[model samples]
Target: MGKMAAAVGSAATLAAEPGEDAFRKLFRFYRQSRPGTADLGGVIDFSAAHTARGAGPGAPKVVRSQLSVCSVSESDALRAGLQPVSTWRAYGLEGYPGFIFIPNPFLPGYQWHWVKQCLKFYPQKPNVCNLDKHMAREENQDVWEQSKALLRCKEVTKRRPRSLLEKLRWVTLGYHYNWDSKKYSADHYTPFPSDLAFLSEQVAAACGFQGFQAEAGILNYYRLDSTLGIHVDRSELDLSKPLLSFSFGQSAIFLLGGLRRDEAPTAMFMHSGDIMVMSGSSRLLNHAVPRVLPSAQEGNLPLCLGTPLPAALPRDTVVEPCSVEDQQLCASYLKTARVNMTVRQVVATDQDFPVEAAEESERDITKEGICHLEDKITHGKRVRLDPDS
Candidate 1:
């Protein structure tokens, strides 16, 4: 089915009727406070038993876990000091209840440093052309054309490209120009401020991924009606690496499925402060945002600064200001649109060294201009070991 049709169908399935308790159950689920919140101590044992009983292969697994909830007492709700809030488990979609509070788990020292740096170097104006614009100007044109051609074709063929690994490329920081006059662009793994790199490392460590390296970070803003179709992120990156995604501001429904593009998978409503790590066997899963609900004018979730508006604002208006009513409304509208910052590790296949020999040596060997040095070294090393003994 076409993307729009599928989106419409999904929306219809999730649509609420008049007087029906659509969000009550979900809201209550997140509001409840249970002790041992961080304790996945028992859940793992239960999951193992369940998996043994013919659980589907795609069933969610307990990857790395953490817990944090809203500090209600500290909350200005009643002008009281920040009280201890309930902790919650951050599992994949399966472990998520309707609502959960994800804390900003950055170390206070590092967080304060970055915030100060950003404030000090804040841009006065937006840059006209950024990595997204350049990418849209270059790769997007080809993708658009390919998509059109696919639509025109009567029968589609799912053939792998000639060089699957080579298709993945890397964009270096030096190549990107920040148009917004801001010191920072959306490029991932840039060598600046040291804090971002550290944050990326923490995320990678939490998710049990090794050799995590990101060349560029894509920053996308979704307002009303902004939507991305069901597509896999098969850009210039090694598919072997995981795509680590982080969402902030507002909330939206995330539709995720299996490797096949046509497979009917599951859907989850991802809110702000949520993190999703897609890796391992699920690296190639197809995912997309079908739609973004309009943000309410006021009373939305507080931004990072604990303020409704930041000094360097991007959107025309804040989705939700600090108000109880606005929070509720923002929560409802978040079911529509949210800003998602997805971090991916892109491996540049072309620049990778050959497994057997150095680049120059490999070229010479391939051209029949030299002996296989790796084999000779192996043979020599084997004999030398016996001789030494």
Candidate 2:
């Protein structure tokens, strides 16, 4: 028997109670910190799918997906830092009908551009981030500029306090998401980045989802131990639209569950430059990141991250090389972190949020005299972690 099958069979031996959530038990099993407690044998690694054919986790039957090679032009694909459509390798699991996974389809050195953008550009003003809860507007602006020096020198001053960039937990672009309300409102909106929108549209077109609009985005920054809770992304007004997720820096274990929260989930590894699209029936599936692989736990960065870019690129290329200073900052931050950007369409073309209903909901909350609380309640006392943590 394969290790994945054996590990999963052992988990089933626990004989969960009638009402117990099987998914949570497995999540906790993988999240365990004690040495020899967590078993990674069951985690699927698509990078090795070619060689580990029948031996990997779940031995998932990987099938090649037909891409609309004609949907995108050669010039356009190159500008987006993507290889020719005919050369791209897209896959779909046997049971996952509408699910698609493209393992690192990016051209050599192209992933760095996106990584730099995530670290330096996206967290700036006009974009909403976790740190905005208590920080002043001026103070929160220019996160990259303020934290660059500290992060660049992080290696030398190993004991220095954490930088603002390190403190960033999440960032929302375009139509910002409300964590407490678990909804997106018309009033709470911002212009999505054009570069990201173009990239999303190109990938969608290649995957047979023509004219997909890039509307809302949620960028999650994770450390080695930080975990995202199990949740379904059904807040979007339009359930018909597909969701695009892009991963960079380090590797992570992604748990994809079924419609019911109690259902046991399938685990997979999401490495840098990997792209996943959950569409059709899989659009609203429950998913979470149980753990981020400790690539930097012992101070080693993944070899894929060190790829060098060519000397020059086409003038029309959407992505280009970043400055040496900025590159240094990104390298320093990525040493112990992972960044994931999920771009999704919130509303259809003819669809507009019911402003009256949202206003009424707010009025009702005010009438009840209930105050919204922030997720972090330090009460003026700060929580600190080791410099590496």
Candidate 3:
């Protein structure tokens, strides 16, 4: 029989028997149906046809199977429904990537309400010194030098503390609240504490996590002309653990790219309350923020300050931090600084290894035994040994 006719015949047979051999015959039919493709392509087409089979008497029916497959395909497999599978190049990243849009996951109107409420708490800007401005001050050079000198003197020890877990929790919470007021530092997981303990338990329940650790929140602020150098957050982190980052602020273009730092990067417009988790071999990938385009603001949406957002804020106004009427006064002065909190788990220090303690215990036993033998020799006396020893 001709290839096409054979395919049709096998498909009919598979419909009747529904066994492995019949399934293979149906797959071969589809493989021969494709015109002018490579042999491997034909094989793949056959496999796809077999895999895409509709349900049968003993299996799920075609309609139900199609719906289930389509649902998973919609939620996790595609990005914006415009790109084809395996063609990461079409997404501008040239690497397999996925994006999820959680529409108002922070509770509808919560962002706007939070801005209005926070304004009430600190009606007038606090008198606290701005770290970035302070760092740029001419007279502060001496202080900066002195601080750097002090940091030089400090030992950079990677010792595991008992309260490492507590530190992780505190840092995560601090990042959530934009590091408001109270001083909190990141902690590694060694001596697990309150925050670390909670995070570890939560992560453990989530499944598939190899290891976990937390670092103190690092606060970054950008002004109108400020630009962050293009760089990836790859140093000092385990390649095995995926990094989870949460952002709050005026939006910015988050550029993600391939493994090499020089490769062209794909831009993702990340906004307030967006959570980005990167892992599965993409952990060490090169990514960065090239610039914050001022022209991308949302006009009708609310602003964090009591002034209207200027026309220059780049991306669309997917999120409004405050009401339209209130933010019209001081929005321009807000500087669009975004706070990002990155959560991760670092490997424990070498000193924390159980093997080191065991080795030390063995040495102590040998030393004590030698001391007893010396004592017997010095006294020149016979000593009875107990079998129980």
Candidate 4:
């Protein structure tokens, strides 16, 4: 069979199966490491022209999406380290509404800034991370600083003790998420980073969402072998607002599933600097990062992410240039890692958090261990909690 035909056959098998969770089946298929048996032909590569199986016979599933270029000023876009709004290549899937995918719209050398922030800035104190649950406050104060010297060492050995940065699994910003309750509590709020909020607003505005408030942020740090389990993001009180996700470092296979578990999902590649805005009908759909692919070259990842400062700085650019030392440390760390930051607006503009109920509401079906699920077959996979649980 031809490549396209084979892809369809593989996907069809999942849909063809009776009484099985198609989304889960596909998730397991992509995460499994059976070298010769695994077929990636079914995966959609948005960076390239690829056919989406269920779109139609011989039709590409990705459709050109229009952005509100006029909504964002050129000055604002530059400040956010993004290319002009007019230059962004946005697309929508055939079957998915309110989902927007922009392939690496970052200006040259700009991604370095975001990468540095995720590693060096966001993990600092005042922000909460998975390690905080078990570690003392003083011990986990500076994740990047504590691990910088060790990570910068050239001779990497398996036996070397892992740095604190390496041990980091996830970091929460703004309104910190509660794993047990699966809700954003009013009392658990922190000052959201202004830089990230600005960036999120610009991107959201360009995507046609005016006044999009970025109230919460989750940064998931993934190693090459890492896999994120299937789950939905419904913790936010305002389901109408879009959830913005930004990717850096190595690429990963993203599976966007339907509302029902039995409904099969469409797989796509999310490369560095890529951004996903899930809103409208697509806002609460199930999704997962089944696998993180190794970079084609350890030295240069995502290809578009060049040197720290590839060109002369624009006057008053918001994204500061990375220092030589910081660049080296970030680059070295990224050679084996990927960072994903998802910004969310938890509450509507007019809405206020109601009194904390005596019992947690069971509206969101988040799988337990969403950020820390361990795959039986793999070492660092984390499962998301289901709302029903």
Candidate 3 runs further than 4 Å off: 1-94, 97-104, 109-211, 294-335, 348-389
Ten contiguous residues with the weakest lDDT in model 2: 365-374
Expressed as tens digits, the lDDT of each residue in 1-389 for candidate 2 is 46545666655543254566877777777666232333666666777746235223344566777888899988888888888878887877766677888888888888888988888889988887777765877997999888876886756343676788888877788876665566664565688988889889889999998989999888887766567767777888888888999999878888877888777777788899899999988877777776777674554567777875655988998886877777767877888888899999988878877674255334211112111111221244332211100
Candidate 2 TM-score, true structure as reference: 0.87
lDDT against true structure, model 4: 0.78
Cα RMSD for candidates in order: 20.0, 5.1, 23.8, 3.9
The most accurate candidate by TM-score is: 4
lDDT of each: 0.34, 0.73, 0.32, 0.78
When summed lDDT is taken over every stretch of 10 residues in candidate 3, the lowest stretch is 366-375
lDDT (C-alpha) at residue 248 in model 4: 94
Name model 4 segments beyond 4 Å from true.
Answer: 1-4, 33-38, 49-60, 298-300, 310-312, 357-389
TM-score of 4: 0.89
Instruction: Between candidates 2 and 4, name the one with more favorable lDDT.
Output: 4
Candidate 3 lDDT tens digits, 1-389 = 25534443444554356334332333233323332322112121111224234212132211100011222222222211111222211111214233222211233233433333222221111211122122343433232223332233223224522111111111122211111212122221123223322332232222234334543222233332233443344433244555655444555455455665434333344555444556565666655543333424433222322223333322422223444544322232223344444555433433232342223322211112100000121236522211000
Least accurate 10 contiguous residues by lDDT in model 1? 366-375
User: Who is ahead in TM-score, 1 or 4?
Assistant: 4
